[model samples]
Target: MNYTLHQLHVFFKISQTQSITRAAEELHLTQPAVSIQLKNFQDQFEIPLTEVISRRIYLTDFGWEIARAAEKILTETHAINNRILAHKGLLYGRLTVSVVSTGKYVMPYFLSGFMRQHEGLELVMDVTNRQKVIASLAKNEVDFALVSILPQQLNVQQLDLMPNKLYLVGRRLDDSSLLSDDPGQLEKLPLIYRENGSGTRSIMETFITDHQLVVRKRLELTSNEAVKQALLAGLGYSVMPLIGIKNELLTNELQIIPIKGLPLQTSWMLIWHKDKQFSPVAQAYLSYLRANKEMIVQASFDWYQQF
Candidate 1:
């Protein structure tokens, strides 16, 4: 009735491993400490929970019963936590999130609005590539992710927020001296592309293959800035997300290449694991995303539709 959660977790770990030393290693505690806790539990219950023969620990009948009961208790405790956190206007918890670098422009504005609504929440954001985002989501390292596409293996619950269109960008639209204005002229111009495992890169590849377009490989870069610099410097033209080049488009630092079927259409999805339970902060943030969905779509997403 009065056992600590740590003690219950340790009990489960020890029972599963069937080795106190292994359990201690898993829990980052000393062997003697684990042994003492087990002994304390046995004394408190007035029953022998463990029997050691030939230096191997085996759970006795009572030990098995307590371990099973501990699992149920832990499960109920987690359910209670979820229910309590679900109450309105009670958003206080840690929310770890990951997003592609291209989404930085759109995600921050939406997240800022959510933070204002839930002032008590703590936020941790990781700007990583698409592969890392998927890996982190499946490992439960991040509570949620805003990504172009979720991995197939993950049991992801996705909300399609808005579509992102890919654009062929260059230094200026007037500088048609480099590549032809015709759509099939993509084969002649040098192409700047993102590194492998990038969501934008994957989308680009699919679009190119589908449209039967070929490009002369000019340069490869990691960041969008690098890609922009390369285009501005007239090294090569590149396909990039419209969101990433809003400022460049406004300042006339970069221009979209005039070609039919140039901007391939793809949507950004707000995704999280289907099996995992969301905390108060994460749920609140999701609600905020859905509520202001139009504003987010209009902010940085309108550029693609304009073309």
Candidate 2:
């Protein structure tokens, strides 16, 4: 009936990620170590807590109950730790952030200044698809999420960060005909699309539908990086966020095709669950963002525009 807080913490991570390997990675432990600890934790209980089906881990009812309890315990423990830090006038703690895949390009600049100012803070950044990022926020797994599109289902408090300009990009080529701005020509171009559930994909879909752009031939890729690679190879044209292709655009490896009603603009937003309590560190970071948002966006776009 006795279990260490460490075991409970690991179990909570496993439940949150739904994967032993991912939990191990997040906890900075080896997979075998995580497995051993999990086994040891289970040995203390008479009933099974988890099961694996088709390579996916599922928590039993007992495991779900334990996980819920563990989450509350861990949350309270963190709150206590934050209170102690506050009393000491220390701005030191872990700050976890989940960002959409395209955010990988620009979030570092925003985080770097904050981390430098608060040297004692630990930053944990997870870059995933929009759906997973939203899930992390909803589960209270991360302190904040950076994304272009906000979820309609979640009650979240959000700060608008910057404009996320999406452009029609392709390999730089000599044929000027490929850069036509005519919307009717869209039907003839080979369009590369992001996978379903991607925020970028959703935006692109809306743009296509709104403009009535018929994409006769499209190749669906899983990531912005993949779509960029496909474009570089002259495989197809893709509507990609400017942040993701800034380097390529600067180097002239890729060119934004001049198209009518182009460069679809969406705002990047920093969001958190409205009811979730923020730690001191999270609060400080949020304040820092509010105070420096203009400079941050300007700096990012300045860099992007330089080339």
Candidate 3:
């Protein structure tokens, strides 16, 4: 009948993670501590909030209802705190951003200075594939979507941040055949591709279809990091963002081939649905980004422009 807010918070995290161990790790608490709190929270109710089957925890229907309510309470509390801070001349609130997986490497640089200015603002970033990011945008779950490929169906406004160039790169092998200016030479290398629903994969597919290049699809990995690893292991070549592979290129671990239609050009964009109302924090970020985008790109991405 009576549950504490701490218990509500812990239970909400447990619901989100679906594993006591993981919830403990995220909450920075011990497994035993999480178990104890969960038990204590459950003791307040006669019915079960969570159940275990096959060693995995699943929330009960009642638990789902409670978790949803708890989320609202937590969100409202955060909003109140933000409003209080705003009265004190601080731009404070949670700024949730859903970014396509590879965008993780780039969004941070743009977000750094703006976040530094608003110390009280919290950041919640969902680094997932393009599908999930688009889904989040459709659901209005985030303040911004950092993406290279904008969704066609969504009515959104975009601010161009920096150029995103994907280059066909392979290991710095001594094979002269792998280095070619001819676009037809693309058929030679076994291509390491990102899985479907990835922006990189989409671009790679378009390039393939346009050139009528029959590529050797060696692997379809799930993430940029995975594709990079496959490349390092000499599995295959991939069209990788220069931003993600700067160190490898500098260390001579990878080399960009000189092809006619290469470095698939796109822009990193800050996108938000046209109809979504802006929170103060979101508004501040948009303003900061618009005012300082040129400067941020100059400071952080000037090296990329050489290619």
Best of the candidates, TM-score:
3
Ranking by TM-score: 3, 2, 1
The candidate, 2 or 3, that scores higher on TM-score is 3
Please give the lDDT score at residue 38 for candidate 1. 78
User: Against the hidden reference, what TM-scores do the models get?
Assistant: 0.67, 0.73, 0.84
- Candidate 3, residue 41: Cα displacement in angstroms equals 7.5
Best by lDDT: 3
- Model 2, span 1-307: residue lDDT tens: 8888899999999999999999999999999999988998999988899999999989999999989999999989878876776788879789999999989987898898999887667799999998999999989999999999889989999999888888888876466775578876677788998888998889878888888877865699889999998998999888899888877887899988877887888888999999989888899899999999899878766775542
Better of 1 and 3 by lDDT: 3
TM for candidate 1 is 0.67
List of clashing residue pairs for candidate 1: none
Given candidate 2, what's the lDDT at residue 158? 92
Q: Pairs clashing in candidate 2?
A: none
Tell me the lDDT of model 1 at 102: 84
> Distance from true position, residue 220, model 3, in Å?
0.9
